[model samples]
Target: MLAVIRYTVPESQSQDFAKQGQTILDTFAGQPGFLRGRLARSVDEPNLWALVTEWEGAGFYRRALSAARLVMYPLMILMVNEPSAYEDVHAQDGT
Candidate 1:
């Protein structure tokens, strides 16, 4: 499963937002079933940021969110909208 959280930060808070995003990635990195995660900024919109993460499944992702050590929840609340989760519908083999 993939989780994507979008944030629209002001120019003055970009640095702080980036730091908090990295902290989220680090926190989830050690959790069970965590696949990978990345932080990205939109090319056309400087203040638009995205925190993308891949997990073994939706359940894994949900559990990670509830973990005690996951302190990124507060930062996540700053997202412009609710986070999104997606399921892979295509095969890597391209059948």
Candidate 2:
């Protein structure tokens, strides 16, 4: 299994941004390579969140995310909290 961890502080108008961001994330469920996902947000920071994602084997997260980021950056620049990223890793399969 592979995990992708992305964290970021969204801009001031986080509502709309987070909505679309969730749409983008939800799209992964329809993706042929997608496995599962875990979405989390900071209790102290409303705009801060970490999307822990799982994939089947390997994938091209960068390129795919680059496209999503393009849409996300412009509308939600003010909420920039932390770093947004995807990480590669090994995990034990529960199923």
Best by lDDT: 1
Clashing pairs in 2: 9-79, 9-81, 9-82, 10-79, 11-78, 11-79, 12-79
Could you give candidate 2's per-residue lDDT for residues 14-52 as a string of tens digits? 566567657767766655667677666778876666566
Q: Give the CA lDDT, 0 to 100, for residue 93 in model 1.
A: 50
Give the clashing pairs for model 1. none
Q: Lowest-scoring 10 consecutive residues by lDDT in candidate 1?
A: 68-77
TM-score of each: 0.85, 0.55
* Candidate 1 residue-wise lDDT at 48: 91
Error of 2 at 46 (Å): 3.3
Candidate 1 stretches with Cα past 4 Å from truth are: 68-70, 91-95
Please provide, for model 1 over 18-53, each residue's C-alpha lDDT reduced to its tens digit, 9 standing for 90 to 100: 888888888889789999999999999998999899
